[model samples]
Target: MNLSKTELNDAELSRYSRQILLSEIDYAGQLTLAQSHAVIFGLGGLGSPASLYLAAAGIGKLTLVDFDTVDDSNLQRQIVHREANIGQAKVASAKSNLTQLNRLIEINCIEQKLSPEALEPLIAEADVVLDCSDNFATRFALNRACRAAQKTLISGAAIRWEGQLSTYDFRNPDSPCYQCLYPQDSGQELTCSQNGVLSPVVGMIGSMQAIEAIKALLGLPTLTGKLMLIDAYSMMIRTLNLKKDPECAHCSSALTERDPL
Candidate 1:
């Protein structure tokens, strides 16, 4: 793709000139980002920041999926929504905010919940998937969908001062999946509403999610097969090497059949 014609014009060149200066994300990388589409699973805390940055970064198209509506309580962390947006659909609010951020980008608001039946097609069309949902069921569903579709998935979670980030790419057979690190039967349950979360903690982690998504879209090195943990209270960051589980139901089951070992 011609960077000058397909990616940026004189107007866009003026808009994105600073980013175009980066050697790593020059005209070519910006073009890759501009042509790529990302699917964001939730529109709450993490989704709010992730969508904002991705749009500002010149990602060509973004599909925002969320069934919830904005509420007063969400204002603390969901920076995309405002006092006037309460009761409005989160996707709609997100689309409005994103458009204001970058008019050159296209934003599609899917005001519906994500389901297993609807997962494959969306995952297939996306260059990268961001998991910002607050619940395990949605997260697991996204993981399975990405794995089946062979799409790159960037997952993040934040509660209080703690946050976790990880990337899963099924294209690499050796990369560990979300289920590999946290088994479905591990029986751990947590929710933002119940556990409580800090607003900036979500911002910090969600921004990282956006970074990973951009890197994945540009075919740059990402957090594949690694977990990044953050503690806001102490302002500490830690990276942990993740291993593919031999018995990982999602990844291993397919490997066993293909290898027939």
Candidate 2:
């Protein structure tokens, strides 16, 4: 990835004028977002709106990873895929839709499953990684890879009228990793297919992930070290502070490696 930033043309400035007008995202912040690369895993409900919003928000580049084909049932919440795209690969559908939204942005599609070796390089190159995947396996893998790469990770999940959001900034020595919250071999893998999820639940969480990713790219305040829990049934939201696990196998050693007594 090139380290240089992209200069916005008049068209781009006009296109993103409303977003640029925000104090949080002035011209400089918009430029920072345009120069950043975001890697997103899974194109289901979460990734759908996350990618779409980020693309519309002017993220310079996006690498979408998903090995699933669009299904008719997914149309309920996976808004990025259309009824005509039932059999199309998720990354392919997402890339097409995202490109249509913002031709100025570069979109990469990965249609195959990625091993940890394949995942780390992509995570390392990304300014921020969005773990929009539903399964625990993929979430743990992404957390581990992001920790190794020292990249910021915005993770989101939703199921059964509940949603979760958090940021793990590995660049900080005391930053807690996902493994710190969910230990290895710990997640029960309760899926949306089994429990059922409200459509907007994932949308809300995923949109928040996009915001956190943009904040991460622009060096702004993010949800790092805090977990936001949403109970959509009652419309309640709560945030909990997260602490680094000194015994965590994934990040504790990295901390010790950097500061050995």
Candidate 3:
């Protein structure tokens, strides 16, 4: 679709010219992308690339939540923050970079932990939520919140050259929530701290998460109800179909209620 000169200024048009050229995301889709808001959890490896791409894509607003501060170790994967920002809160550093990437978008930096109390309000306001956190606690927290809010959740995780991406939409009756595939009580333990991660692997998966979020917001088909696994070591990509669990407390209850539980 053609965009009026006023609708897309020279700078705006130039910035997204390549993306706007795509028929699926021309001026109209770019407009929708520019008007959408996304909430991203974490500010580490996965979050770093996801937030940067979304901001660069001209997402109208972004809410970034991260309780950590920039560190020398993060420089390897968290490309959004610089060495100069080592001591600064990750959210602040990320916001600063995002603002520079796209001045037209609004960004909210929450330099606080993602607690249950704060999850609902933030998730409610976002058209889509990106779960880029590394830990299970935060991941589960985000999943629960998104399920309750019936918001589409795009989750990505990367460690040791292996990455996984999944979309959870509790609003869809047959869709599986994150909790359905990975039970909170399963007691599976894995972390970047415990296992090394390739920096580029995080970037690859995180950027895909941003793509999924944008697709979800634009009502385009996505990886929902499927888990995408990637092994950077072998450059192999696999898709696993996910099914809603009848015994999953979070999704099962929502299923029974026929609404966000």
Candidate 4:
């Protein structure tokens, strides 16, 4: 994605004034966000809020990926789709809602499952990538892609009354990746639909994902190399520091290969 003009017009200044007012963000940070492209995979509970906030916050371009159709069951927590969109594809429904929120931003929709080839180009184009995808396969796939590209990836997952968030800035060689945290693929995956999720648990994590994405675009401090764990039932949040694995399959070898000769 091309970096759009940093200049904010009269209407843009008015729309994003509150964010621009923050000393940390100010006008320059907001402009950086306006020129950044965020690629979000999955338009479910987590992706819904993430996409909405990113769009409303004035991110210049957003690429939404999801192959599922909206279902009545999804309305419990997926806020991007409506009753009328039950049969509609998730990316389509998300694009409609996000466009309604911010018409000035560019929104692209992908309605198919991505192969590694497909994901690579998206990762290459994105300033930041959000892995809101459910299964570990997709998560691992995305982690590998981001690591190969040395891009920034913000990932979130929620199941039952628990949720977790993490950011892996692959540009920083010291930053641990998603695979560093979950090295093995568990055959069986836990999902909100199969177990149960408190609706707001996903909302909280998703909203935080958007914040991390914006911070990435603006060079702000983010959750890179730390895992945030939330348990709604206990009302507790904990962050665990992560370290790069020297023997890890995904990144360690690559890091060694890039070592100074």
Expressed as tens digits, the lDDT of each residue in 41-120 for candidate 4 is: 99999999999999999999999999999999999999999998989999999999888889989999999998888888
Per-residue accuracy of model 1 over 1-261 as CA lDDT, tens digit each: 123346467777787789889988899788888788899999999999999999989888899999999999999999988898899999998898788889998789888775677877788889899999988888888888788777899999999789999999777877788889889898977888888999999999999999999888777899898999999999999999998888888777555332110
Question: lDDT of each model, Cα atoms only?
Answer: 0.86, 0.89, 0.85, 0.89
What value does the lDDT take at residue 98 in candidate 2? 86
RMSD to native for every prediction?
Answer: 2.9, 2.7, 3.1, 2.6
Model 2 agreement with the true structure over 125-150: per-residue lDDT tens digits: 89999999988889888888887778
Worst 10 residues of 1 by lDDT: 252-261
Give candidate 2's error at residue 76 in angstroms: 0.5
Q: After superposition, how far is residue 33 of candidate 2 from its true place, in Å?
A: 0.7
lDDT (10s digit) by residue, model 3, range 136-243: 888888887887778899999888989999999766867888878789888877888888899999999999999998889778899988999999999999999998
Two-way lDDT contest, 3 vs 4, winner? 4
Candidate 4 local Cα displacement, residue 93, angstroms: 0.5
- With a 3 Å backbone cut-off (N, CA, C), the pairs that clash in candidate 4 are none
lDDT of 1: 0.86
What residue pairs are clashing in model 1? Answer: 160-197
Clashes in predicted model 4: 0
